[model samples]
Target: MSTTTSTTTRSPDAIRGRRLGVLLVLCGAIFLEGIDVAMLNVALPSVRADLGLETGVLQWVMSAYVLGYGGFMLLGGRAADLFGRRRMFVGWLTVFLVFSGLGGLATEGWQLIAARFVTGVAAAFMTPAGLSIITTGFEEGPQRDKALLVYSGTAAGGFSIGLVAGGLLASAGWRWVFFAPVGLAALILLGALALVPKEPARPGRSGQKLDLAGGLLVTSAVILLVLGVERAAHAGAAWTAATVGAGLLLLAVFAAVERRAAEPLVRLGILRSGPLVRSGGAGLLFSGGFFGFQFLVVLYLQELRGWSTLETSFAMLVIGIDAVLSPTVVPKLVARFGNGRLIFGGLLVAALAYGLFLPLGADWSYLVMLPGLILLGLAFALVYGPLTIVATEGVAESEQGLAGGLLYTGFQFGAALGLSSVTAVAAAYADPLEGYRAALLVPFAAVLAAAALSLPGLRRRAEQPDAEALPGAGAGAGTEGGTPAGAAAGLEPARG
Candidate 1:
């Protein structure tokens, strides 16, 4: 007791070095996940050509991964909670590396599809584990905020960079797209081993069996739901209806299972949180709008305008501005305006941009599209980080991985539905320009609906003290033995 000292001076260089190491490994994982998704999208056509995949089978190349990733996410997240985070992270990364290489070696369509699905499953486990580590490892004020901003910006960067990288790799050969991730995964694995700390075994998780029944029910439901939405564009109406109906039935069963489970894959009680519910809904709409708009724009540029892959990639690079703005500018805005107002405003801006694009012509220049693109990028920076904060802030450290998984599940599901629905709507019209205009309306309405949904959050925020009165609003506050003050403030409504 006599030797105890409360504080000691630490070198700035040592502190900075430690934080940088943590950020690099965490950001590297997120970046790889983002790039893998986008890279495959760009290389799909080339993959089909090389394998001589049938038109009906070609869509499965994308659909398989979506299904695997979306379906297994809950199980993955819960697994991270039960297993050590570092253990799950490194193990899953190894799985990802192996499968990505397998994908590159596949000569047949089904083999590639299988590889993609397995790789997606690996990512499902890896992503939430990485995110939870960052959320829990960094103290919950500015240090965590800065880390999150960098993490999110890196994610956006990976997607943008992948668009360019995919085009370049596909030009060499479709297989290279798959092989490239292998090399990146190996490097990331080495870095993770060197830098990511080993988490101790959780106090009570040693002997618990995974909720196998719950996992099966929920995974089946998600797989079916995604399949129905994805095929709605091309499959028969009756078939799509049957598939979606079955999915809903399974979801009901899953809900019942969760309520009764000894170790539920998801805690049903988490749904009682208003902020979590609102964030999930808004995330769904935001992701839907973003993905749908991208789908429409890619079709317009490449199919109608007859641009090469390289040209389309470059034209879309404007969205990468979110990468820079998110880390540098968004934190200041969040501190000033709070997450609710900023998310609301971002949605409205996105709505307006989509509306502005409704008047597109067959021969409209990239200059004409530039304004909407830039606005979309800015909106993403404003919205995505705040949305993440809202979703994960009040959550206990134990369940942060589950919360992250839920948010991403909504995102993947929304993206699947939005892209398919908009493509179907556009395809029904014979005139190309008419199709483009018609398609734009779907996302416009989606963004507007999301904005309307944000009203509850805004009203709740209004009832709280001004932002300046908050403990962590203007400065860093240490998280010592309890929840950060900012997190406590966010959890007030939930505790009600």
Candidate 2:
């Protein structure tokens, strides 16, 4: 009898070069996506002027992108899982590049909107695919933690950098905002083709079909919900209420479909995971508050105070501090104080920052807002990175894409709600100062809610072992014997 020699094929984590390359490429792609969003907002007025668009039609340039991004995310995430992640990522990136160029070239309002919508759809697919790659590619330990922190930091930086880039570019021409992303995206695509590893096919996914029924219902629900929120801000109550009701009904239907489908777009059972659910809720509130606050601040600084776009961008740059802090500072903090305390503390700090803004006056000094802005930036550095870790930690490899998608869904919906609700509240008051003050309340309350939601997670942390004591807790250079981050966080190890 001969003994068989078995070969153990190590995961991509074994190679440092490939892992770093993949992370850098993903960060670049995510950064481009973030910049694309913020830059467009900065150029919106210019876009309207250049295209001779009506106020109503101009809104669509922004709304069309949101609708496509939020609506198609679930379908896109599931497609990454079922099809190949690399294939989906590269293909969608190509689409994004092409449409971004189209958007830059478009003379008509409708043509620009169409290009934006398609680009958003492409981002829906590309983002989750990139995130799933990170979740699966890196070994689940400090190494992975470091990568994620960098990822989160880059994303925040993109938004901040985008605003500055937009202001500078818009001065030259509004079209450059769209054209810039094309060049950045093309470079990333070439890098990805070389650097990103091709995800191996899961054993059972080859024969599986997409849950089209679930996709349609969910997409329709999201689109309707977003429309209703925006309509409530601008239109009659009756139509808004009807639209919202229809969206709720479709959401209920989608849940039912998911429960019955052989291969569901979203596995309903995963919603039962407390960490995932709570993290999603907290992220929602956090994002909503941040976006609402930003919108009001921009209006206050630029429109009311007559500050130039460049000045406004510089004022907001303090909020981008997270890009530096996350990769450098947060990992050490996470290893010591834990994610729960940091998230809760961050939320409260952010709330206090917004609270300071509640005392706004027509001739307030920039010095008065400076402290709050710095605090808010610190809060973001503390919160965004760890919240992401919690959201995707417990999930299996196969469903990591779905988990990432759900977290981002909360983010997108929260932003829409926050911006729309605050705008509506502000519109209700005749006095501009009073309207701004009233709008400030929305973010303050939102942060309070986020802080409260984080309390349960602290209890969840107590139930688990010490993060350092757990296997792979802070395994710096060596990979053996330590528990992965998820298991340390009280979640099971991922199954292939």
Best candidate (score: lDDT): 2
lDDT of each: 0.81, 0.83
Clashes of each: 0, 4
At residue 308, what lDDT does model 2 achieve?
89
Model 2 lDDT tens row, 204-264: 5578888889999998998899878755788889999999999999999999988899988
Q: Which clashing pairs does model 2 show?
A: 471-482, 471-483, 472-482, 472-483
- Model 2: residues with Cα > 4 Å off, grouped in runs: 1-15, 460-496
Note the residue pairs that clash in candidate 1: none
**Candidate 1: where are CA atoms >4 Å away?**
1-15, 460-496
Model 2, residue 47: distance off in Å is 1.1
| Per-residue accuracy of model 1 over 271-361 as CA lDDT, tens digit each | 7656667788898899999999999999999999999988898888898888999888888887777778889999988987898799888
